[model samples]
Target: MAKLILDTFREGYGVDQIRKTMTVGELIGFLSDFDEDTPVYLGFDNRYTYGGITEGRFEMDYGEEDDE
Candidate 1:
């Protein structure tokens, strides 16, 4: 199995927050146990070096309002 590192995130106070970190094996195992199509969130560093499956999905909301 391939080794992987991961970070977790969640929505809080209208913002995303880091909840924890996990391993790829652990994540895949957990995911395998669950029914397919289950929603999840995978976190990654700014450089995209580390990431893992998450319980909640993360999304970017950047738009014109945030643009300068």
Candidate 2:
């Protein structure tokens, strides 16, 4: 199965100060119901462009404060 990730914050600019985020554990919780073999694709730039998971791995960019 294939999964798509929507970009919820598409219109924002200079959002470096915004601290709203989800933790890895929280994200995992959200996906707890999904099958382990499901493939995930990131909806990036727009709904048309997608970033795919390679070898069951993907990278997430986060700010310093998100370490807490």
Candidate 3:
């Protein structure tokens, strides 16, 4: 698996400052710099999980909140 790093958080990226969506073209542009053989994984709760893209079923999740 390819290791992806997000060092921007240390530069002051927060929930409110992060983008919530990306178009396919935008995604391609963002990933154009990376190697083609890299595996894609989704990050959540500081953990990375392999998205079922190859299985033809991709799931999108926004995570959960305490709502307290």
Candidate 4:
């Protein structure tokens, strides 16, 4: 198992973190539980080397807000 810190979306500039020890697949599944449109930050320690904005489900937002 590996430790991970997740930066979950809360609002415009708000974020919450979840620290746990789990496999990468479990971490991915955990991330998938949230809104795919929102950005996420993944890290094991002081630095976040992975995670991004696009979930690979659609084109880039380009600053376009969702119709909803």
Candidate 5:
């Protein structure tokens, strides 16, 4: 099983926004507030490995140490 974190955002006059830390099947259940066929944009912060696919998904680290 994978751990997932869901976050949502609504703009002034834009489509409903949803973000997740990792892809999960149950993630769709959280979108009940929105339309059933609404278009969604999914994104994540991860490293691209092999054939340009994201792997070892991890949050970006930024700081003096990261700048080195």
Candidate 6:
């Protein structure tokens, strides 16, 4: 297992971040809290972050990390 890093910035909500020592499986449940339109940035260990647009799925596991 590795650390789970999640960050987000969206329309209504301001910037948010979460750091936890968990695997991919644990991330799904936590992600359910956000709306489909919510955008998120995900990272594993010390790797580059991936950006994700939560637009349709009720829950998501991955997204491209757009830091620009």
Q: Find the candidate with the highest TM-score and give its number.
A: 2
Off by over 4 Å in 4: 1-20, 42-68
- Give lDDT tens digits, candidate 5, residues 1-57: 332332333334522233334345555567665665554433234322122223475
Q: Which stretches of candidate 1 lie over 4 Å from their true place?
A: 1-20, 41-68
- Top candidate on lDDT is 2
Candidate 6 minimal-lDDT segment of 10 residues: 8-17
Cα lDDT, model 4, residue 8? 44
Instruction: Encode model 6's per-residue lDDT on 1-68: one tens digit a residue.
Output: 23334643333432234333466677677777667556555654444546444557556535547732
Instruction: Estimate TM-scores for all models.
Output: 0.28, 0.56, 0.46, 0.29, 0.23, 0.30
Alpha-carbon lDDT of model 3: 0.57
Q: lDDT by residue for model 4 over 1-68, one digit each (tens)? A: 33334644333442124344477798688878666556554543345454544457546445436532
Candidate 2 Cα errors over 4 Å, as ranges? 8-16, 54-68
User: Candidate 2, which ten residues in sequence have the lowest lDDT sum?
Assistant: 6-15
Query: Which scores better on TM-score, 2 or 5?
Result: 2
Q: Between prediction 1 and prediction 5, which has the larger lDDT? A: 1
- Tens digit of per-residue lDDT, candidate 2, span 13-41: 65565677677898899888788877777
Query: For every model in order, what is the number of clashing pairs?
Result: 3, 0, 0, 0, 0, 5
Q: Give candidate 2's error at residue 65 in angstroms.
A: 10
lDDT on C-alpha atoms for all candidate structures: 0.52, 0.69, 0.57, 0.52, 0.41, 0.51
> Using alpha carbons, what is the TM-score of model 6?
0.30
- Which residue pairs clash within candidate 5? none
Best-to-worst ranking by TM-score: 2, 3, 6, 4, 1, 5
Better of 5 and 6 by lDDT: 6
Clashing pairs in 6: 36-54, 50-64, 50-65, 51-64, 51-65
Q: Write the per-residue lDDT of candidate 1 for residues 1-68, one digit (tens) a residue.
A: 33333353344654334355456797678769655755444445543654445447556668566553
**Quick one: how many clashes does candidate 3 have?**
0
- Report RMSD (Å) for each prediction in the order shown: 12.2, 4.4, 8.4, 14.2, 13.6, 14.7
Ranking by lDDT: 2, 3, 1, 4, 6, 5
